[model samples]
Target: MPLRKADVVDEALRFIDSEGLDQLTMRKLGAALNVQGGALYRHFPNKEALLDAMADKIVEGIGDPLPDTAWFDQVRILGNRLRTALLSRRDGARVMAGTFSPGANTVIGTDKAVQVLSRAGLPPAQAGWVSFALFYYVLGHAIEEQAQLGLPPDHDWRERTGRLAVEVSPQYAAALDSLSGTDPAERFDYGLNVFVEGLRRLQEKERAAQEHAAR
Candidate 1:
């Protein structure tokens, strides 16, 4: 049977999982599929197209509906969900940050997030901007989290950096030491909460300024 496009995407993801993204090539994929390199071109015009498909596949499950909750909770849910999706596959976060088409899945996921922000009183443009900001923040955090996958769970990055800093200046070492026992997952949640809180504060400030201007 001839391979379908979805099959190609599935095999490509498997290839990426085992071989890593850096080693992905049309020729290699074709070899893995037992087809000529040109066969992939019929489905994807080029490597970038294949990468975009892979990225889309990585994030395809991000279109879940917003929960029945407060605006803050909605945003939190969306953010965490996106992070979870990106962390599902090997180097999935990097794939998401790379080439991708703004297809239905991407559009729906973004729309849900923007709707949450809009309900929180942000103007349409601001809500969209906030959604974009949150997406990038989650993507960057996931990338960092995945990059440390090979390290031991108890490894203290701050301690390693603190040692070098202490050799140069104790002040910097002390600062780094302050962050010494924080886990990456904890840090991710902390940063996300901070962002959500900041948005709340901004919404309040905007309303207050508008009231003041009206009076």
Candidate 2:
């Protein structure tokens, strides 16, 4: 049977989940899906094209912004949701990290993120810059988090903490110890709040400077 685009993307996602991104290739993917190598060529001209398709679909899973969601709500929800999706699969963040695709989902996701920032009163350039920064940070963190999710021994963090405990303040060590078993969701919320808060502060400072200069 001939494979459809959805089938191709689904197979690609599953292959990434099982084998990790480094090992994913058109030849290998074809074998995984029980199809000939050329089967992929019919849908995607080359390995690069195949990757583009996979990246597009992955970004596509980021749903449209809810009408009821405010700027903070929309941006927060989108950021966290995307991070989760990418981390859910093996090397998923790595696959989507530098992918440049013009697919529907990729474009729409960018539009929604930018729109949320614009609604908050930012001009086109600032909104675009910060929105991209937020998304990049989430992707970068998710990749690191997923990579460390399965440590053979949890003692690595302990050893590092011990080093910091010796040189850093006791309060720092205490804070680190306090989060030995911290909830991932809580950590995500805290970090996201920091990012958005920083953005708000920047906007406020810019507005204040403008007002002072006008006087």
Candidate 3:
């Protein structure tokens, strides 16, 4: 069977998963596919194009937000889905951060988010900004999460942090200790909840201002 663009992308992702993103190259991907490096250019003009495709693939896995859900819930669902997708592949967040594909899946997901926010009563501009804000929040967190994955299994993050805090700023050690037991998922949910609640409040304030203007 002949190799397709999708096949190339799949192999690239697999290579990334096994060897890490930094080790991926056109030559290696072609070798994995048993073709010359130039053969890849038939599907992707350059390494950048290939990376964009990989990032789109990650976004495609996120699927669509659930129907008939509240806007806040929809936002939460999308945020969680994106985080999971990024974490699924090794260095997935780095791939996503490096490329701006504007591919179909990216466009569809973004449009759906903007539509949800718009329906929640935000103006188009604000809705767009909020969509980007939600995306950045997820991306930033996923990047940090993936970075943490590189740590040694026996790493005691709290202990190290506490020691550093005590050495540099004893007064802030108590605050640092608060992070002792919480896991990444718990922290992610807490941040997401706080963000959504702030958005809810903003929507209410917008509504109240409109009502006042009408009066």
Q: Estimate each model's TM-score.
A: 0.86, 0.82, 0.91
For candidate 3, the per-residue lDDT at 43 reads 93
Query: Given candidate 3, what's the lDDT at residue 20?
Result: 97
Hey, what RMSD does candidate 3 come out at? 2.3
Return the TM-score for candidate 1, rounded to 2 decimals: 0.86
**Which regions of candidate 3 are displaced past 4 Å?**
61-65, 154-180
lDDT of 1 at 136: 93
Worst 10 contiguous positions by lDDT, candidate 2: 149-158
lDDT of 3: 0.88
Q: What lDDT would candidate 2 get against the real structure?
A: 0.78
Instruction: For candidate 3, write residues 86-149 as lDDT tens digits.
Output: 8999999999999966788888888888888999998899999999999999999999888878
Clashing pairs in 2: none
Model 1 worst lDDT window (10 residues): 173-182
Q: Which model scores highest in lDDT? A: 3
In candidate 2, what are the lDDT values of residues 1-215, reduced to their tens digit?
66897898899989888877888888998998899988888899887777777877777767664658567778888888788777677877877775776578777887878888898879989889987888888887777677666555554555786775567777776676655467666777788889988877887898899899999
